[model samples]
Target: MASNKFKIILWSVGILMLIFLGFFLYQLTQSESVNSIMILLMLLLGLILGGVIAFLASKKLVSEPAVITESSHTIAESMRKVFKVVSAEGHFNEIYNYEETTKLFNFIPSKKKALVIVQAKVLVGYDFEKFKWEVDEQNRKVKLLNFPAPEILSTETDYKYYNIEEQFFNLFSKDDLAKVQQNGKQQVIEAAKKSHLPEVAAEQMRTLLTELLAGKNFLLENPAKISETKNLIDYRNMNNSR
Candidate 1:
């Protein structure tokens, strides 16, 4: 906003300067005084030099540092939208086999046995609702305050049970199979986390921000500079050590 105001003032001054120069040139052209044409030419040359100086002065003023504050709320909201914009997924499968046998009575008994197989996948990356950032407009830079670490966002599983032999005393219920499916889904999520799928998503976000801000003349400040801080911080807290 200040930049816009500065430009308006500069251009206003420039236009007035040009108008005065034009008026003087007109009057000189009508003059019958000695060396009138020569004087007019010199005035035109002086006007060119003055105009150049004025343009440079305006540029210098515009470039001067001004405090531009961007709130955490604004950045966080925008980043949240972009966070859900694209998501990364990790695929995994685990072969889980379980056998359980149940016998009834001491000497005469029928046995119940079953075989199970499970496959699962995990979704990893930003959820968008949890986003945080800080901006320093004066420096034309932004800092990622807090971001979701690599984690399993969601999981899907498929399972099959076969080769079952059950007696009246022993049975496998739907509840039992449901428990196995849930376990399989959890295992897949843990595996995905260990594989650093979330880290891959984080890198993607970094690239996204870099590209997003490039045209805006904004830079993403390095995260390593404040590696110690676990949350978002004010721009003043940043140090030169980075």
Candidate 2:
């Protein structure tokens, strides 16, 4: 909007300058004693004023500040409407080696081994149901008393069997294949976790909340650790102390 307004101002200024130049030419024709220096000076003044207007037009419209009049509950409710916020996507190529252990006194190695190449897409996101927060208009902040940790929201996996060596005595069964599939999925999840997917997702969420509260000029703060098992401690007293 601001850019469009500035563009309009620039075109208007250009047209006005052209008109002024045409008028100066007409004055040149009308009077031989007309001071060309004075006319140029006047045009310079007009250009300066036009530049000022253009600069003002390019500025942000501060008349309507983002003042969040809605209650914290309302904001939270609106956020819930967003449901599962998938912030990052990770494509993983993992090799999961699945083997059945020869459990002879728990000291035997599995002679049967199958190399499973797993290609998976992992979605990293937040569960808003676990989101705990409070909007403190006092501090101009939406304090995430309990910011939900990024988790593997979903994992889609495709497995390709590479080297399948099964002993005649301990052959692969349905249960073994199931274990392989599960392990392959787990490998993809682990790979996603080990990558920067969670960090990227967290940064994205922070950016999102920051923009959402930009109108209010509010900060997004996560004081409590989402990895902790305990509930977010009542932070009102803490904030009060601060």
Off by over 4 Å in 1: 1-86, 101-113, 224-242
Predictions in order: lDDT: 0.61, 0.70
Residue 136 lDDT in candidate 2: 89
Prediction 2 TM-score vs. true: 0.52
Look at candidate 2 and give me any clashing residue pairs.
Answer: 66-215
Residue lDDT tens for model 1, 95-162: 55545565556656656555666566655445455657789999999887766544344566677766
Q: Which candidate has the top score in lDDT?
A: 2
TM-score of each: 0.50, 0.52
